[model samples]
Target chain A: MCNERQEQDPGKFRDQIRQGKWQKSTSGACPGYVQANLVILPREFALDFTIFCLRNPQPCPIIEILDPGNPIVQEAAPDADIRTDIPKYCIFKDSKLVEERTEITNLWRDDLVTYLIGCSYTFEEALVRGGVPVKNYLQQKDPGVYISSVMCRSAGVFWGPMVVTMRPIPGHLVARTVQITSRFPKAHGAPVHIGNGEPIGITHLEKVDFGEPPVIDRGDVPVFWGCGVTPQLAAMKSKVPFMITHKPCHMFITDIKIEEMAIS
Target chain B: MCNERQEQDPGKFRDQIRQGKWQKSTSGACPGYVQANLVILPREFALDFTIFCLRNPQPCPIIEILDPGNPIVQEAAPDADIRTDIPKYCIFKDSKLVEERTEITNLWRDDLVTYLIGCSYTFEEALVRGGVPVKNYLQQKDPGVYISSVMCRSAGVFWGPMVVTMRPIPGHLVARTVQITSRFPKAHGAPVHIGNGEPIGITHLEKVDFGEPPVIDRGDVPVFWGCGVTPQLAAMKSKVPFMITHKPCHMFITDIKIEEMAIS
Candidate 1:
């Protein structure tokens, strides 16, 4: 089911996931296609959350926002059923994770509003293409994720510190990495902090709020970017009554190519 | 009350407008600061309208979306009142222009949501600075605005053809113009159509749906950009129950500088 031919097409790959035949991380599948971080919230919290993303665009660049109660994505993927397309999903009640599901067909509601946010994985592809070595991509492991001290602009009920992903880029290739990633603003776009993470509130390089620990080379510089997981952290801090999100690294693949999202 | 001293400071300039001492266009004022298009809607339509802007960011880039019923903008300008900050405003009822007013304080409602959309005026500043001739800026006339045949991605109750502002640029400067404007994504960055307008449904270049007739010169190319007036046109087409917008050429100025909005 995970043959090279099937993995090259987003539609076919999505089919395998929808049928519960594939459940691995979506990192290398559908190589050139876009992957999105999912956030499903009730209509009541939709407005504030949308404004929060708009205000803090770097960390939460919105890719596609579905109309309330509509699970069929229109723009990113014309007919993709968001409720069952992703390989995995986490259900949160009052900011606490209560369950994990392969599909949310039964949990879906008419009032749920889904947001497909730009994920760093999209830009990481560009980084790799630009000759910047992405250790996590090479190792096939999740990037180191952390909670930065940077407080995002609060929009109504949504307010919390920003969450970021850290990558160790070779010192000489740092400039090239920034240039390449800056092209995809819809993706996390350029690094938020380049050299030092301490100023942004990352105290210990070894500590990570999420994902695996970093594999840093001796001459590598720490590069930090706004993460899509920010909204989840904010929702948790706000203690949202109920929300659904994709499991980390198990992003929902979209029909859009990386080039379609690049600014230049 | 309009003086060089007051014009330089957005706060002072807003005060003069709030006091009804200034009643002219906002073009060329606050030279480097950002200016915004205003859109006020009821909470019933807030979610859908926001989604519409998110989907069509090139035309309706959102700079600031005030909290429902909260007239004071927080990020754009800390204490500026959305109700009275702009020089002029138009009140719309059932999609028809009901009244032109100096302020909407009398009509403020708790259920009302105010959206500060990015204005092309902000990018025009970059063009002029980059040596690109902005005829409208030099002649003190509004740019040619027209309704294109291209329809926007619909979001719930809002859907309409994209409205564009046409500018005549010398053929040689076309590439540079695109580069300069592309920097300010928040300000409807880059041209949607360049060279010929006929392809985008402009049958006659002189026939504009709104604003002043264009001043086209020989060896000039017609460049079209996504205009911020798009949302107002959509609101009217949808015949929303109530809405408020700044009068054409009048805009809400923010403290953010043009460089702050530039992507690179």
Candidate 2:
């Protein structure tokens, strides 16, 4: 899957996905461009969820928000359409995954508001550029994700524990990794925990909850970052009647470059 | 008033103001602690205003937001009360300044939600420490403020132009000043415009719109930062029926250290 077609232009890549010619995970789809987590909710619940993102920015850094009933992503990618850009979409009804579809034109609602959230891929690129070897990138696999006991600050009807993604780094590069990733606050920023994940309620590194189990070398330490999947977990836990999110590992590519989101 | 009393503990400093012994502006009070701009709005408009802050983070960096009908500032300072902690309060009716009082205890309502926004004093401190001499600091006066033509992203019913505060810095240290201030994104972050104010519609730096007029030295260049007063300007311009804000320069001091809010 890591072929020449993956490195093509972001808009052209979205075009392939939109045309249903490509429907796989977007892990290595478009390098250098930003990939975001998508969450669409009815206007009645949009305000509380927007506040939820503001309250817990680490897990859910917003890239851009579209006006109600608008399918065009104006800020992140003006030419992209949210309804069919992503390779796959998850439709949740009464907190249960009811169906998965290639396009959500049938489920689109006039009262729905879309939120584009920053993903860990942005910071992962920074870590790699900073000479920190990420185990997931090295193996060309998704990092392990776990639902931690750390509860996010509840906002309105949204209440749930935080979900985090884990990446093991060589012990010598832990500090440097923190410094490099800190520059992109919009993309999960710094590590929430380092050295051990016990305090966050992850007792077993081998027994994972989501994605593949991480490969930790002898001197490598497991690092955790607030995952973009957190808001989905929260929405599901709160029993939101209607919600839409990008399928796991399938993201919405944006025109924003990784450097543009960095603070320093 | 750079007296010993100014360096006292934040909680104790609030005690002085709460007891009526301190009634002056909170410029130098609790030096190392974070000072914030205050905005109290009814719960009906709370969600929109929160979204407004998230959208226009530069002009309105929210440090903490209290739950509706709650006066206790749990995150920034748990022991303080929003209704009477500040030295002064301005009451607005139909977006017009209707009354000024030392405390709003009598006008307190359960539906009000308080928002504590970041102030420029944090970044200014960093600038002073980084060898950048701010003219307003040397002259013991507040920086000049102006209503700029830069329009803020409107949220719901909130709509207005951005308000900016100007500090004259030595031409050689303009870049250094930006670097120092950029670390504190929560505190107005970096300069919006560097040299000429006319581009931002500020034709007269001498005839200031708010605060004291700045003193630009021979080799100094005027730098502008998004002012905390911006949200207030928006609220007033939108003609919000009811609002409560701290009197100009009378800020809410929090226990969080300035370094905690720095990005890198």
Candidate 3:
């Protein structure tokens, strides 16, 4: 099933996910298309969260924001429905994980505002294309995710520490890696920290908050980029009455091409 | 006085403006610093206005947003007060211009939120530095401003046509002009419509809605950039009960250097 998903058109692929025919992570699906992290909140909490994303763009780059009660993603994927297109959805009530479901049609409300944030997958692809090898991609595994000591600029009730994803890059290629990823600011842009992570409060690179342990070889520097998880953490910490997001790695694929997001 | 203003530090220049000693346009004042557009609104209208700016970044690039009830611009100018920093401000009521003043201290409210948006002066400096001539600068006059037929992507109650500032660039340097200005996305980035103004609803190059008439030579083409006036136009058209903005060409100078806003 995973093998068949590769190279499929975005719209057709969304149909497959919507119909419950595919339920795996969307990592390698539609290679050249953009995949986004989902965050749906009620209209009451929309303003602060939107401001939070605007202030902390490194961790929360908004690709498209759906109008209140609007289920269609007009900018990213015009024909797709937000409630049913993703492979999986997580419901949070009062900051606690309440349930994980395949479809959110039953829980959809008229005041819900959906935000599609850029995922690291886009920049990772750019890194590979630029001849800079990403260790986790080469190993076909998830990169290390950690809770850094750097606090995100707070917006209203949203306040929390920044979370970062780490990739092992060869020391010689760190500069080129930054240049390649910097083109796609929407996809978490440049590295927040490099070489030593201690300044950012990461004492142990081997012990990560999420994903597989990183493989850091000699002469390899652990490069860190702002992670999409920062917003989720902020949402949980803020204890908003209700919130919804895509299950980790189960992103919503958009019609936008990767090249279209490049700054140059 | 003009020579004294040039090369003067942002802090000192802001003090001069705060004391009502500098009532003229901010152009050429604090040459290397960033100048910003000011928008003040009550807390009730902040969310929608902010969302409008985020949705339409090219026209309304935000440099910093002060928290509700907080008048100090901590990010852009920490010691500066939003109510008194700019040389002049325009007051609007029910979408109509009611008054113009040097300070809003008497009208200040605890619920007001301030937004400092990027101004084109930063990019115009970049153009001059890059050897792309800006006709208005060469002529020692303000660039032409026009209300175009291009409609902005509406957010909530804010909706109106985009306003553009025109600069006649020599045909040979139009491409270079684009490359230079594109570096400052925070300050009205790339040209929205190039060469033909009629396609964007401009019938006469000699007539403009604001500022001086443009000077277009036979070999020069008119280039349009999304102007800061766009948000003000939207606010007026939306008929928001009350709003405040910097008077034309009288902008708030920030401590940030021009190079800081440039994208690599």
lDDT of 2 at A249: 85
- Tell me how each candidate scores on DockQ against the true complex: 0.87, 0.46, 0.49
Candidate 2 per-residue lDDT, tens place, A91-206, comes to: 99999999999999888999998999999988887788789888787577899999999999887788888899999888889999999988988899898899788999999998
Off by over 4 Å in 2: B4-7
Give the alpha carbon lDDT tens digit for every residue of B80-143 in model 2: 9998899999999999999988899878898888899999988877788789887676566899
Q: lDDT tens digits, residues A1-264, model 1? A: 124655678898889889997787888888888999999999999999999998888899999999999999998988999989999999999999999999999999999999999998898888898899999887777899999999999988999999999999999999999899989988988899998898999978779999999999999999999999998899888889999999988899999999988998
Query: Of models 1 and 2, which has the larger TM-score?
Result: 1
Local lDDT at A232 for model 2: 92
> What docking tier does model 1 reach?
high
Decreasing lDDT order of the candidates? 1, 3, 2
After aligning candidate 3 to the native by TM-score, how far in Å is the CA of B98 from where it should be? 0.5
Q: How many clashes show up in model 2?
A: 0
Error of 2 at B167 (Å): 0.8
Per prediction, fnat is 0.86, 0.24, 0.10
Q: For residue A136, give model 3's deviation from the true position in Å.
A: 1.6
After aligning candidate 3 to the native by TM-score, how far in Å is the CA of B17 from where it should be? 1.2
User: Sort by TM-score, best first: what order?
Assistant: 1, 3, 2
List clashing residue pairs in candidate 3: none
Per-residue lDDT value at A69 in model 2:
88
